[model samples]
Target chain A: MARRKGVESSIALADAVAMCKVDAISAYPITPQTHIVEHLSEWVNDGELDAEFIPVESEHSAMSAALGTSAVGARTFTATSSQGLALMHEILFIAPAMRLPVVMAVANRSLSGPISIWNDHSDIMAERDIGWIQIFAENGQECFDLTPACFKIAEDKRVILPTILNFDGFIVSHMIEPIEYWEQETFDKFLPEFEPQIRLDVKNPSTMGAVGVPEIYYEARMAQHMALVNSKPVIKEVFAEVSQITGREYKVVESYNMEKAEVALVMMGSLTETAMTAVNNLKAKGIEVGIVRPRLWRPFPTEEFLEVLGDISVIGCVDRAYTFGAASHPVASEVKSVLYTSDKRPQVREYVMGIGGRDVRIEEIEDMFMQLIEVKNTGKDFPIQYIGVRE
Target chain B: MEHLNVFASKLVPGRELFSPGHKACQGCAPALALRYLLKAAGPNTVVANATGCMEIISSAYPDIAWGVPWIHVAFENAAAVASGVESGIKVLQRKGKLAPGKVNVVAIGGDGGTFDIGLQALSGMLERGHDVLYLCYDNEAYMNTGIQRSSGTPMFASTTTSPAGEKVPGQSTGKKDLAAIAAAHNVSYVATANTSYPFDFMAKVDKAFSTSGSKLIHIFAPCPTGWRCQPSDIIKLGRLASQTGLFPLYEYQDGKYTMSEDLPFLKPIEKYLKLQGRYRHLSKEQIEIIQENINQRYEWLQKLSRVSQED
Candidate 1:
């Protein structure tokens, strides 16, 4: 069993990575994500972790370097946020296309033009199509635990695709909370020594990341997509194994107080944890509100989401990232699209809230629930609401 | 040690890392340069190639020219990728998973990839001192993307992006001194070679791979299709380029500069420029300007080489 102690999530993430025994890390400093790499660098410098930390110039080179190391059968890592992630946008596609199992930590922050540095879903949302196994963490514990779980899930021979663990920039990354720090012995049981199946070996010469001509490009992409889709089972299996070792159950999609609820709030990231409190507050008043948080974002648990929306009349989806000119925000639009072809479809209301690091208060979440209840009673969906936006 | 002059008859091994029957333009200088480079580095080397003429020609999904383990990620990241490969192998060897001193890493890129977009990554790799050899095949422009002008494009050279017209002359700027820029990093070895002189180029590669530190070899690769020269004149142009003082063959090692092939008398710059259609439209005044520029640069190199010998 690991020792439970209170620490910042970034530090906890560093500890988890150290325990995982990665071969190399190449990362550039970016806001909110800096703390994670900073602590890892210190550990490397101090000999607590035996790894090579390549302080690359930009996120472009960071991802590029990570690709190199990963190609050579090394367990590699990198972290970035906002513009840094955006800068790495080109190579992000290369990671999964090449099937390199590099793990990355993305501290979710808003994309710029207005140049805000606070937390938002804009970063990860912008990179949704990069074909990596992506997941969201709602709290410090989840962030700390998912750090190592990402490596396990990514390096699995069945998966062998890159993975990104997204935690809301300041909310989860900077927040200090009680997290279980695993010893090397404990992590050894969860993640064994990595033995790469295909790598740049001089003895066995092979070409990797070769150009895909027009004739074979479609099949290559189709194979990549299938690999991602098939990773769903491996993700669950790894999570189950991790749960057994840690005694903390995890799932692709987690439900809170969804039993017998007519109305609910759908969300992801740290806001889901806040919504849980609002669910408790609404239950006190006989409101019967619930929360559905999609823990796995990329191979989005579509069936699980549909199953959770079963028998429910209305759902208020709280989205932190806007889709610009789209009809609704990111998560809300995905929810609506998935239910568009489903049989037992809920009247989903879009709530674009807490963007740019605005705190999602329990009162605001309660108000969202009330709005969902009203929509359920009237059978008329409210227009997408930008909560806390000054009219 | 055998003198570099006799290396042409020294019998290069028959084993070719870069296979034949690949797509490259007729009389392609970069292709020949790569052939010579791999001959020197041997089959024990892994290459990180950038997206360019070499990458596209060599790795087209089902048909790969590389006999050695090679990776082509993107246009501007071969150096960074090579850094990773070197570091990863270092750790693997440390853990006894890989045998030590068996493989060397090499990053190859075109002029655009090296002098422009890939410069930062190359700089970082050099400064970090990874045991990787970065080979920039300076074909002077972005040939794969339809002959666009790059930072390495010489002054008065007509490219698609930098055309010589009534108003604007070819490329207004002189070619960026990438060799000096690399030498500024104080890496273990830095050199300038041309495909016209394969023996000298291969000898430099042999010296570079002998050390276990950062090294960069900038090769002057002529593009017949891009430069609007005859395919038969490609190797001739490369020879004239160095013989005419336009592209000197030299090396910088441990703060010491030495000319591997210093001519007794530099031919007129016109001998080099007149063969290519890219510089066919240059007026007498423009030709003089180009000549003067080449003269001044060669003089500066002579001074540096003399100073190093004195020190």
Candidate 2:
């Protein structure tokens, strides 16, 4: 049982992992993500948590160790940031393909090139298609709440896939907030004990992660894709169940002040809260603007996203990462693809705002809304643009 | 005693862990070596294999050849995975959830997966003192990927990536000494064996399973296709290579070095080199250079063995 109180979001995240009773944790130190693992190690050493803390050499080994631990039917957890997450790239694909159901937290940071250790979405964005259930947290409370939910959803029999939670590096990961912690009874009822479908048991032996030749490779990949896509409902149900236990509600796509609003902003991560504040400021000035943020990124809430943008005339997407030389950015590109074939498509404008930890304040978000309103009124959708750039 | 003999005749355990009718080439040395290894390890064992010829040939989707519970994650992670498995089992057993037994956790990899890309993970696994045995099946090159050269490739050996020509000879560098590297970790046991002698290889494997902490076995398994030798010469080549002072069979245990079989008189290196077509392009001068290198390495090993024995 956890005492409900104020704590650092990283500590809260580790506490939630402890409450859920993870059997193994493999980790290597990297910024912003180090606190979570450090707390886990302290818990293990202090005898607060009964788990194996595998202090590995690199993030690649971290993920690989998680794979092995999970393969043996043990509930496993790991955390990384920036290049650490990037280093675990190849092993990331194996966890889901083998149906290990390992839970990971990625403190979203920018990839290296003049190297900054601050917050951005570039690290997780580069791994968008690695086939894990990716979810974003907008604040410290969400970080605490979603850590357990990820384990529940991933370990569910119908959706035995790996899960990754992305919280902005140094923004929410380093922030302290009052969190509604869960007791053992609350967690146990909401998320039951994990029962692996297959394990390395001598009594009932089987082969896993075997060679998929050209004859069966396509079918194997198709099965994995279908499994990930089918996990959306499980994720929603787990979130609802967890929310019922602790009165903090969650949705796949959350909208703020969208009632009778004409223009809306679409974004993800901690910046969504800033955009919501911008919406509130605009609302006080009688400018009807709203914000929509998708908490679930991977099994991308296509239906819920389209339903949220139903009658809005102008929709502006604020992306924190760029896809160099691509026609569009990350979240905006997915948003465009979702609305491309729909009849209710709105005038979409994408603004690449926070690359390598560049600040995106309320004023910048308000300017983005102004640009979206102009694009809606004039019917001239501009090319993908950057905000706060020194021209 | 008669019933026991009948039971042993019918149910020879661990030999069936690696079944027949797989995709390995005819007279594959690694295959024979793995069979002997599993036979020594017994039935209560779990294995993790890196992506290579062994994984690819043994497990082709619905038609797997492994009888024991096994997994193959990716290349360059077998040691790390084995570490996790060993630690996980220990924790589970400590918590009284897992049934206690003599279950050995083993990681198997090819030369490329072991000596090159997988070295860091192996080093980490050893330094952490995980109770796992790592087996590196040294086939000299990346035979699964069509004879490409890896860090384990011998000097002056022709490979697809290191072809011999007028300007350049085959491989420019010598094989990385992985046994010494494993020894540097101060592990419990480290040994080098060849597939030709099943008794020697199995003896080392038995010792590894009995010892507690990290143990590694570097096996010299020749590739008939990659070496451009007759399939019948696989075992003969293994023996000849050992006899010619190229790949000595020895073990380092508890800071003590012991040779499985000491050489009374070292054979000429030409007897080993002339058996393979990959070394066919070597001139007289190159052969003499390789022979000199082998002699120096052999001398170093002998000195280390004497020093450790005296200590």
TM-score of every model versus the real structure: 0.98, 0.97
Evaluated on CA atoms against the true complex, candidate 2 attains a DockQ of: 0.76
Q: Which candidate is the best by TM-score?
A: 1
lDDT of 1 by residue, B1-311 (tens): 25643664456876778999899999899999889999999989999999999999999978999988999899999999999999899888887777877687999999999999999999999999999999999999999999999999999889999998888889999899999989999999999999988878998999999887999999999999999988899889998899988999999998999988768889998877888899988999999999998899999998899899896
DockQ of 1: 0.84
Model 2: per-residue Cα lDDT over A7-59, one tens digit each? 88899999889988889999899998999999999999999889999999999
Off by over 4 Å in 1: B1-9
lDDT of 2 by residue, B113-207 (tens): 99999999999999999999999999999999999999999999999999997888999999999988999999999999999987788888989
In candidate 2, position B267 carries an lDDT of 88
Highest-scoring model, DockQ: 1
Model 1, A176-241: lDDT tens digits are 998887777878877877788889998899999898999999999999999999999999888887
DockQ of each: 0.84, 0.76
Off by over 4 Å in 2: A1-3, B1-14
Q: Where does candidate 2 chain A have its weakest 10-residue lDDT segment? A: A240-249
